[model samples]
Target: MPHQLAVTIRAALPAARVAEVSELLAEAGRKGVAGELFPFAEVTGVHFARLLVVPEGPPGADGAPVPASVVYMSEVDAPLQSHLTDLVRKAGEGLEKVFGHCDGYPTGSASVAARTAWLRAHRIPSAAFYVNTVGRGRQQILREARLREAIEEFLDQQGAALSGAPPSRIRAAVQEHVRGRPDLAWARSRPAPPALWWRIRQKAHLVALPVVALFLLPLLLFALPVWAVLLRLHELRDAPGRDRPDRRHLRELAACEDFGAQNPFTAVGSVKPGRFRRATLTAVLLVVDYGVRHFFNRGDLTGVKTIHFARWLFIDDKRRVLFASNYDGSLESYMDDFIDKVAWGLNAVFSNGLGYPRTRWLVLGGAKDELAFKNYLRCHQLPTHVWYSAYDDLTTATIDTNARIRAGLFADLGPAATRAWLALL
Candidate 1:
């Protein structure tokens, strides 16, 4: 549920205002919280948010430069309208201040309703999105996190007395301890189930794929060979991006990293020319979206699970793309995991970029050319101006463990099951 807002800066605006915008976001990013103008934390249900200005990226295949734009991103609970309403109510001044630099913004005195409409107007729909856990919400994550902490404290205090006890007895004792604490009373009730409409939509999405595939089988049979030939010809001729990122650019990017357990990445690049690459990119994104919505909803994204949230969006009329992700650990490890575990996935989509490392068969050889791939990524990377996280201290793995502990806190279990549950502690 990350909302992407991209508004082009007016060519008429003076350079000083742009510098001011960056400074404002820098202060907020350093604080890791909302500013007086924009109380982002005041907006309910936001797990992560960022504001960054994307400069003109590399030229398109047609030699056109992508215009500089300001992007606002946030991952929040569903019913995004409610969050938007809260944002306008609490941060309207800040919205005006930041977006006012961009074209088509309402005047400073514009009504809240008008500003909200403008925001919705400028919104860009993500082509694909990934959530660490599909049904988890901000409040639930925080509450479960606290539950884990309290349980850990209890175990520390009672370790001697509970020594060698059966897992069931230990679990029962933990339940009793939780019941006695009024602050933890909320966990006594089951969390609300996902809404009926969402469940129906997910099922419909999964069901539609096979039906559509079956309907298109004959078309695919004829198109597959042509597609293969076109892909190979493009792969053979396309220039692989291999130059290292500028040192100053790397320094600016490094300034915003390693400040916490999570880091935000934003990168933008041009799409390759012509209908063939564009069509292939579209098809790949559709397939990726389907798999993420259905098969990968639990936790892992094809066996890599460090990401909290990620999104892909097309810009400049599909001539350019901006990819953003909120992930755990250092950037090096994150890149390593992608290269070693999901290189094919990287190739399937990124191979369509203008200067990507050459790919073979749309899913091989691209990201496998490790140095060139890394350089390609670095060359396109943009430094985030402001990045905020609701639970920066906890990671995807920690969150999953916490949720499991809460789920088993009041459940009945056999010895083996109980032992497994206790091991989660």
Candidate 2:
């Protein structure tokens, strides 16, 4: 019964003000949270990501959805009725500068009329709008559990009916079984008690982590020049894929009408990572994701509509460290923000992975090859791109809602076709 709830407010602004509005939300999120760290490393429900609504329309001759409403969104976790109300009021203040006046969606905890209005608007199909920003990690796990259970239940119910059924028939029958009762496969939400490791890590990081980062800074800096030389040498060793990128992915992205704004140019690139640090690719990505994803969630970067979705398996990763993300601006601008804002931490992590001077210069993009990697991204990236939907979409959101639940249900369901059917639901 304890679901993630948030008082989502929508303010329509001119499309041009997306960046300015996003910055205000981030600033407000920081101030709203007041640097209040949650217990352990739990996600604070106090902040939210941007939701740029692509107006419903056909793409122009150029093949991009005509920009429509630029709605600012954040689902702050309001625990108490009073708190939710106040947060709504405070959020309105953030919107005023952009929307001017109190013209944005005005639903507040303190006001009965406003609250009732918002509720009335979402009376039907009420899953998308939320008030809290809890992480979907547990929800995702539980959802997968539910999907598997549903698959099992469907198989059992159709035991006699399925014996002579063809693949298509079996899939259709399973879909009929789960229809409006998708809840049959879902697990109830569980209480989130902070784990021991969380407690220890948080405590240690509070005092020790920063000092350690500072301590490691000079050494990381000193190794930069040496790292640059090695990365450049590596790029020379292994060149770009001779098979010109077919833009096969562009067709896929082109069909997508799910996000607010897009760069249209999708870059698909890969690097044959050096040996010494290649093993830790995932570990590094996760650590960095943990540290910086919040910044991203708080709108730290711009033109990042639907951050990393449809992350083409090969789009960002398919063996040998492939990465991808959409940007609001040009690739160069994206790289600049990345280096200035995020690269310091990434560089330090690379230092740790490559073992700094002990192993010395084996890591590409470790210290100085940041641009070298940028060049690689530029070269290999798809020249044009498209996305199907944004995270806010109920359909796409459900895909990862349980962390790719359809994929998880594959074993129990037997055929991928059956799993695919369930996913489409």
Candidate 3:
């Protein structure tokens, strides 16, 4: 399961300490997954992880500065509690060092249990979450990636000797190569299937959707006009964010970007005030959560496959939203993809945030207003202080490809299937 943890920096912390904390995180970012302070690889099952200090936005009605938060978020295979246990056990000293600067961290006790409890206390439940492919754990990914490389290496050494061979012959040779190697022997067998209860829940959710829709049909019809009127009224009077980001802010965001094949995006913005907007955003996220779990679990989110994991969470009494994603490619290309492929989906969720590009309905005309939408995103975007990826060399597409190759390695295949499998090499 993908999980996140966020803790607010103590507003009472001296300014000099905050600067030291920032420098510490920047140093970790430079060291990447193997940093001496917090080696991300030491804590297993994490696909991606990041530590960032993001603003909580402007002062509240009390006119006091809201503390900027130190967010430690990760996507892991096990349940969050289990992952946190591993995190504390493996990186106890490093975690204490980093989190000590934050508010609410137990000061006197440095025990693993105490640190884990604090992390649990500050945990934020995502309003919605997405994984490009469910059930693909870090261990499986690394193993299969190694499998692909070994097969490719074998093919290279055999060079052209198998060039004119039949598909079966080529596949047979590849299978033989894998079978003869101890390390690649795992690829000769299939992995365990998902648990029975998981399958049952998936099917049950699929079956229940239409039934629920039918039950709500009459109420929906009755409320349609009123809902439309309310939505249009809000849309007409809503403030649209059109301001350009400051040059220095843009530079700061860009500094940590484009360093790897994958990049981390963390943005926070105030939610549009009032019950109606909040309800609309809530409903949208509910539907998105359903669709991603039941529909988009197979590596695509509405034709956009670049994201490995993404999440949205409502924070600070639902007055603000935090959007974060681990995506492949440069940020420019990423924005273009959403604009070109799934602009309406962007409009659906983001239009409820303060200073978004205008939307006609809940799903149209917002992200389609490209320039304004990009500006809105840049304006809210925050610089990530540190980021890590388990497989920095692989993109989502490459991971899918590797999994497919592993899946077909020991399968009985027809000529067409064999040819397709060979093509994957």
Better of 1 and 2 by TM-score: 1
- State, as a TM-score between 0 and 1, how close model 2 is to the true structure: 0.29
lDDT per residue as tens, model 3, 57-143: 666668776666667888877566678888888766666666777776865656777877888888887888888887777888899
Error of 1 at 289 (Å): 0.5
How do all models score by TM-score? 0.92, 0.29, 0.92
State the C-alpha lDDT per candidate: 0.82, 0.39, 0.81
Clash total of candidate 1: 0
Ranking by TM-score: 1, 3, 2
lDDT of 1 by residue, 4-27 (tens): 222221222335566777777777
* Residue 405 lDDT (model 1): 83
Error of 3 at 102 (Å): 3.0
Between candidates 1 and 3, the lDDT winner = 1
Per-residue error (Å), model 3, residue 337 = 0.6
Each candidate: RMSD = 3.0, 23.0, 2.9
Q: 1 or 2: which has the higher lDDT?
A: 1
